[model samples]
Target: MAQMIAPVASLLFSVVLLLLGHGLQMTIVPLASLSLQFEGFMIGLAASAYFVGFVAGAIITPHVVVRAGHIRGFAVMVSSMSAAALLHPLVAEAEAWILFRFITGFCISGLYLIIESWLNEFADNSNRGLIMSVYIVVNYAAFTCGQLMATLTGPESFHLFAIASIIISVAVMPVAMTKAAQPAPIAIVKLDLRKVFKTSQAAIISALVIGMVVGSHISFAPIYAVQKGYDAMTQAPVFAAMLGLGGVISQWPLGRFSDRVDRRLVLMVISILGIFASISITLLDQADFLVFLIVGALIGAATQPAYSLAAAHGYDHASENGYVRMAAGLLVAFGLGSSIGPVVTSVLMQYVDIDALFLFPAVLLAVLVVYLAIRVMHKDAPVAENKDSFDFASTSATLGGVVSPELLNEEDRYVVVPDSWEPSEPEEDDTEEAASVEATDDADPTSADEAVAEDPLETKAKASA
Candidate 1:
């Protein structure tokens, strides 16, 4: 175990430091927007920009890594991220912050790409799942720690942004000084939504819906807590932290439970749980902070792992060779939903009550529940033996859509050739062919006589050779 971990320990340490800064920044951004008196729509737009940058990073960062290499690319991204973090304080305008948010999103996605691809290099079929599980745990733990750090200073002050920048800058050290070998160049996954949807409609749609509901909630929850009279510096951070903590605690058990039963059944149950939790939050509008926090945690427990369950369900039907592509498609679906959710919810919050935050997700979750029920009734689940073992899914939850060749088996590690691509025939070289015959004749004086004596087919084979 120590042998396995030793190579990636610096990578993991970097992850902790990076996520600590990122988590704190995630908490600070919306709260800071609110302090700047930006409208709800503007706040949500800024949040959506981050995911847009993430998707953009998915497309562009691979080329960056390929050209500059991992360590250099990682350094570039970390510098951009640190600059972006500090820029939020200098340029308080919503529009400038939107651009900064996009930069932050792009850099963070690239960082995850470098880190995950490095981790994947040290992993094989025997231990890939365990390595990724540890990565996911570290991600959530670091992010949760960062979220809690919001209490160290107010979002309105310059200090929190500076702290976030400093922490993000410090993240560079472990990765820079690491002696582990760099992984292969990262390749962009050519997402085939059509193929993935054909594999499992329930999975793709569930990813979309989960992104819409969860993404919007994460962006707005701190604002909601503040509006509910909770202190932004104290109670709101705790509220945010509790939500992640709930997902952390329940994800493993939920994943294992789904392995035994139909995953669609599991999705339906969680969506229903999500609906109840949303309703509970509404009813507890006047309840104490602790009560609201508990309900918030319940909501996280119910909804956060649904994407993973849906992914597990998709894998149950996907060809083993196609897992990377399928996961990429799912992330695209989720990314689209993540990008769209905040804008719609923000508009609703601007026009309607602040409670529209929860109301919007409640409606989406109910829709997801109905959809899962239909899927359950329409098709049978994969047999127990056919079901893929559940691994913690990071597609939409953490990694964005950053799939790489490392995720594929060693023999299968190549750029995913598109289904539409076909091999072209090699052109014949008449001059080279004639030269080869001439050389063969010169090399063996009897070759011409032997050619005539040889079988006609043998002669043709020799000529071709």
Candidate 2:
């Protein structure tokens, strides 16, 4: 572990700083927009613009990395994001902020691709899981600490923006000075949506819905707190932190449980719980702030693990060679849904009550429940041998996360045999011996049944047929 940590420490530090800035910026933007007196719809639009750019960047950034080596690319992206952070305070209009948000999103996505790809390159199969786990922990911890920074200064002030920019700017120094060799350029994945859907319909749908729920919560929860008359600095961070805390608490247990059963059943259970939690939040009076926070945590615990479960389910059906492509497709689907979530919820919040934000997700969760329930009735549970072990998936996971199957345990590694590789034909004597055994089995129906029963793969194949 020490050997693994030594080389990648700089990269991990850079990620922590970058996510710190991101965490601060995420909360600051919505709160600042509210202070600027922008309408709810406008605030939501500005938030959604970031995701729009994120999706585009996911598609386009790999080429940028290919053109410029990882080190140079990393510097360029961090600088761009820093500049965008500063620009937010200079212009307070929704239109200007939306454009800034887009730029920030694009740069952040590019940066994530660079950093994650580097991490993947540095990690071998031996320690990939540890590295990935540390990376996720840093992400959550840094974001939580960054949220606390908002308490140091008011969101309406320029100081917070400056701090965010300064943090992002300093993040560049570690990577820029690191002695580690730059990773090879990453290839842009060719996403086939139909193939991904065919691989796991439940996974694709769950990704979309989970994206919507999480995106809206990240972008608008601050606004919701303010509307309810809670202190933005204190209560909002607690609210956001609770979500992260819930995710941290639930990811492993829920993920481990899914590995043992049908993942779709887990998804159904989570959706039902999420529906109840959302409904509880909607029905609870504003005065019950503590209960609201508790229920928010429950909602987070339930919804946050859906993406990982869904991704694992999809991986169960995908070949090893196709893992990266399928995961990328799921990320794109999630991004698309995230881009739309804030807009729809914002409009709902504007025309309806602020509670509509929670209600919208509840309805979506209910839809997921119904869909998964129906799908469960038709499809057989995956045989244990065929299922992939679950990994803790961050909502912020980029293409790099999907590309590195080394992060999984050795037994769970998806090995894609090359299409050109074929089993050697048996020698003439061996073929005759095999035929004799087959003939003997054919002579005894009971022996054939026993043979079939002993081989789970054959049994599964026959069952499917």
Candidate 3:
């Protein structure tokens, strides 16, 4: 195990520090903004801006990495992220914070790209699952710790922001000094929206709904804790940490359960649970800290796994080689929903009541429950033999499409062979196989849209004929 992980250990170390700082920032931002007298709508707008930058960075950062190279790009992003963290306390205005949040979002997206793609490159089929599991565990643990760290100081003070900045700045040291080989430049995955929708309406729609629900939950949950009389010093952080903790613990069990039954059915169950949890929280007005903490975990467990289930459901219907494209489309839909969720939730909180925070997600979860029911009625479950195994996916802002090992099939894989590698003696068939490969390489590459599945109805008609 140690031998297998040695090659990418430095990258994982960097991830630990990076996520720690990021987790702190996510917890602090909304609380700080509220303390600065920013309206709920402005807080939501700021949250929306960050996600907008996140989606934009996912699209544009590849080009930057391609031009600047991974190590250099990683450094630049780390520095920018650190600066953004410090600027939040410096400026103290809602408008300035919005721009700072956007910058942080953009840098974070790029940083995830560099780190995740490097991990992807380092992995092979033999140990890929183990490596990914390790990454996921580390990712969640670090982020959760960071959230808890918010309790170290008051959000109104600049100390917490400084601590976050210091952590982010320190994140650069391991990667910069490491002697590990740089991974290949990241590829831009083109999204096929129409094909994705046709592949599985359940997946695409669930992605959007889950995105909105989770996005609002993450951005505003701290504020909700404050309104419920939880002090930012201890209670609020514990509430946020419980959410992360629940997500980490519940993913595997829920994911494995979905592997046996219809994933759509599992999604409906999750949506129902989310609604129940949200309503429970709303009803428990000014509950004790322990009760609020338990409710936060329940809601997290209910909603956090929806994205993974939806993606797994899509894979059940997607073509063998189209996994990457399918994931890209779902990611875009999720990003759009995340960007819009906070704004809508904020408006409700501003004009309606503080409880709208939970009410908003409850309503979205209800819509998803209705949608999933309709889908279950309209479409038969994919045969067990045809189902794709569930792989854990996070609802947090990340480059999930790149990190998922299942998304890249052998035929469509992007690997970078090392310069030290050598070919073995060739067999008689090698000459012909080499010639075939040469010819295939010389042919024009297929456009991204052309690689996705055709219309489902047209495919069914052709199959019937």
Candidate 4:
């Protein structure tokens, strides 16, 4: 285990570099758009253009991996990033950068494919969970730091662009120089909505909402900070930290707490907490540093687990194959939501105060919470008829379909809830395979505390966080 992990730890930089490079690069695009006299709609089109690339790359990443192999594939992907970032400052107009952004997004999707596929192939079944958990943690941490890099120079400075390039260049060193055996090619996850929707509509809705909310923040949070009076440096860390710290503080408890209760209920509480956080930010009389911290912490906590909650809720009623298919479909919905979220949120920020940044998410959460509440409460209101448990063993589609979050079996199908969760004895496969697999990669806390489902937005004073 130690030897395998040591090698993994070295290769882990691929994820770090991938994250930092993308994080730093993305922070500047929207900021640049605003400075360039681009309209809100154009800026959004620029922002969402990346998703088109992201989705396309994901669809074909498998072929690239299979044909080229991991090391070669990874190198090819990172080189594109270098090209995209260095050429960024060279582009004279917003329109050109939009094309660059699309290329960057497309390349980055392959990058994730290479890394995730590597993890899937190399991680001993027993060790994959731990390796993956660490991989996610590193990606999250580096991303936050990359965002912090935004603060290194003002949005308009060429320094941010240069730094973004340098990060990508350095990303090549770890894997390119390594002697590790090349892993197998990547697999394209074909997300069929008809199949997934047949399993559960709630899943689709949950995936969309989560994507929109998260995508909105990444695309515009820096701009929001600039509006709130912080410079780029402060903005970078705060934005990245908000999301990173949100996962840091919440993943464990939410994972654990979710196991003990109805996950939908947990999501509702988180949503309300999220609303309260942003609402307080909106109403604050002054924009203090502490204000950002407090608001970020709260909002992050509420929003971070959103997908998971939606996933758990939707999975409660999903079939085994449905869980796998739905997971991938969720990624698609997430991509769609994320792609659209920025455009909608950016317009609100451009037309309204920066404080209006929260309005998009707040409104979404508010409606979702109310609808979910009513659905659960009403005797025959739609959307609450299933009772499946969350299954972490299957590969799940999250964050736009490059790879599923949980690396469960891509081939086998099984029910979501534990057989014990049902009134009957455990299924044979569930009984033997589950125990063996759980014993293998048991450290992923997401496994320990997931439950089957079931939100509100409390109003607050308006001030920017």
Candidate 5:
């Protein structure tokens, strides 16, 4: 327990630093882009660099960590991100910023890999749920705080960048100080494009749209708020509040209930409502708090689920052996969608105004609605009645919380390995637990806890969440 203290503290600080860095950088990026007289398309290009780089890094990160080892890989990546943040004001050119953003993305991927793999290692199977939930909460809290930091300072000078550096630099101390066992090297999972493509077209399209929506929301919402009559100071915090609170409030009922029902209808309903919210926000130029908060929350609740909706929808069409490959493919697709969303929306803002961003999502969502409507008509629509609610298990209580990958997609990422999880390599103890879990999963498909005893990570999840 004492040994676990430092690493857990480090993980907590990681949440804080990530959110703080994100909020500070996000507030700075767009304001700087406009000051430099960058076009919406160019701004899009710059923002896309992050996701583009992240995707590339994710592709290679697992292998690099395996070779260099966890601590070294984490140290290198965090330093890279920190260095990039520190360089932002110095290199201060649009192209330079884009290049820097790409580097930052590359660095953070290793950070994510290290942290997630660490959690995986720390948590045995029984407590995985609790551990993951706590992690998700911490993550959500950090992101919200990151969004809120835009109010603290602006891109007018180096103060924000300095603050970003402080956060990044501080992160290193926690990691370096921890005495926890460093994780073993891991092999990167190489995605098979040909196989994925042949399996589900929905994964491709859904990934694209999911990426577009989420990527733009994070990078541009501050500017979008500014255009909506908000000062830059007010912009970041409010947008953060919307996204941070929105998903937590809606996840439980929506995800849980959907488990027992058909999800296609839910997807259509969410998209339609999102379209309405996106379009409706344009009608409000008021200085009211309730309105923006309401709109932000609604938009968040309405759209955040799209990623899961699309992923689950695609998974419905896949074979049992295809879950992991499908997840990778969907992640790539979502990344691409995120990469493109900002530019297109930003360009739309040019012809009209900031209102274009909201309206732009509305239009794209409308297109999705039509497509799904057609699918529903053709009877090829995604069915939501299945219990794929693992990844989306957290309900309204998710607001200051984190959601775990295990809860989100267990069977896909880590299989239950009873033999590997024992305190001692007692093969007899392991086999007994395994036989027990198999019986549980067969009896209660929705119960993730039954399989917990057979896995060590599950035990860790309970402690953390």
Candidate 6:
């Protein structure tokens, strides 16, 4: 672990700082927006806007890196995010907040791309697994700490925004000072949703549903906590931390079990569990914050692994050569679902009850459980030989993170298939010639042997047929 950490320590430090500020803002924004008298739907729209930009950034940021190189791109993204963070407090209107959130999301996507790909460049097969594990640990730890930071300042003040901006600004120092050379340029990922869906319907559907569930949970759970009459300082951070803790503890075991069985079966079980957990949270007495915390952790445990399982399942069907494309497609699908989730949940809460936020996920998970149950009946699991080994993946990961060569097994490294290597259909004339040859062989074996000797092409065509 020390050996793995030595090579990318600077990059990891930058990631920790980046996630800390980003994590703090994740909760602070929704809470602050609520304090400013923004309605539930507006807050949801603001959150959805970030994901909208996230999807755009994942698709377009590679070109930014290609043009500017990793270090320069990293610097630019960090600066942009810092500026966006400061802008949030200056603007009071929901529309302005939405725009700033989108910018922040866009910059964050690029920043994560730069950091993850940089780490990938420094890792080799021997240390890649350890490196990725440490990365996940850092991710969970930093974000949880960030949520804790929210306790230091109330959402209505400027101090929290300043703190978020300063933290992001400080994150730039480690990367800028590092001696590491720029990594290879980011590759342009081509996404064909049709091809991706054909690859694994269960994986794609699960990605979308998980996106909706997580998006709502992250964006609105703080609001729900506030509605329950708990202060942001204690209840909100604890709520967020419990979710992170649940995810951190559950992912590895669930991922390992997924490797040994049909991933869809694991997914089906998760969906069913998530349905129960969501319903439990919705019906539980909100006055007892402890109970909410416990059930929220259960919700996290049930929902958090869905994305990773879905991704692994997708990879089981994807050709080794198309791993990057498949991963990118899943990210896009998840992003689309995330963009829709919060708005719908918020509207549900507006027209119904604040608890409808939890109910929204419950209904979605129920549908997913039913869908997976039906899918299980119709589709046999992929042959074990064809399955990809399960690796823990984060929903927060950018495209570069998902497709990093260092994270893949040696056999699964990105490969380019030649455009000219497509299979060709046999021509009618060739088929007819082969038929004639077969007829001759049936009629007279000796004559057929002589005919083959006369025409090598006939023999080759006959073999092809």
- Specify the highest-lDDT model's number: 1
CA error at residue 26 for candidate 4, angstroms: 2.4
**lDDT for every model?**
0.78, 0.74, 0.76, 0.64, 0.64, 0.74
Better of 1 and 2 by lDDT: 1
| Winner by lDDT between candidate 5 and candidate 2 | 2
lDDT of 4 by residue, 1-465 (tens): 576678776678767876787777877767766666677767777777787678667666666755666677778888887888877677757778778878887888777766665665566557766776776667667776777677777667777888888888788789888887654333334457887766656657767886778777766766666666666555544664575576556755675566566666677788788777778777766467776767777777788667766666555655644555565666677778878887788778778767767877988888778866765565231243454433332222233342333434424342122111212344666877777766654566344233211000010000000
| TM-score pick, better of 2 and 5 | 2
**Residue lDDT tens for model 2, 139-244:** 7788777876887777888999999999999999999999886654454455678877888888789888878887788788878878878888768767766766
Off by over 4 Å in 4: 235-237, 378-465
Alpha carbon deviation, residue 21, candidate 1 (Å): 0.1
Clash number for candidate 6:
0
lDDT of 1 by residue, 1-465 (tens): 777777788889998999999999999899988888998888888988888888777667777876777888999999999999999999989999889988988888778777776777787768766777787778888899999999998878899999999999999999889887666556455567788899999988988998888778778889988988899899888898887788777888998999899989888888888888888787775689889999999988898877778777877887877776676777677778888999999999889988888899999988988888888889999999998777663433643452322244423442331111111333465578777866776699775445323311100000000
Worst 10 residues of 5 by lDDT: 456-465
What number of clashing residue pairs does each candidate have, in the order they appear?
0, 0, 0, 20, 48, 0
lDDT of 5 by residue, 1-465 (tens): 444443476776765676567556765777767756777777888888887777777667666655666677777887788889888788767888889888876666556656766776666556545555666666667756766665776655688888887887777777677788764444334467677767766546655765676667766776777666666665645665686477666765666555655556677788899889888888887658677878888988887766666666556666665655665676677767767887787777777787877777787777777766776776654454534553543212112111223322234443222211222223555687787866766698645444443333321111000
All candidates: TM-score: 0.86, 0.85, 0.87, 0.80, 0.80, 0.85
Candidate 1 root-mean-square deviation in Å: 11.5
| Alpha-carbon RMSD to native, per candidate | 11.5, 14.3, 9.3, 12.6, 9.5, 15.4
Give the lDDT of residue 205 in candidate 4: 77
Mark the regions of model 2 whose C-alpha exceeds 4 Å error after superposition: 393-465
Best-to-worst order by TM-score is 3, 1, 6, 2, 5, 4
Off by over 4 Å in 1: 393-406, 409-465
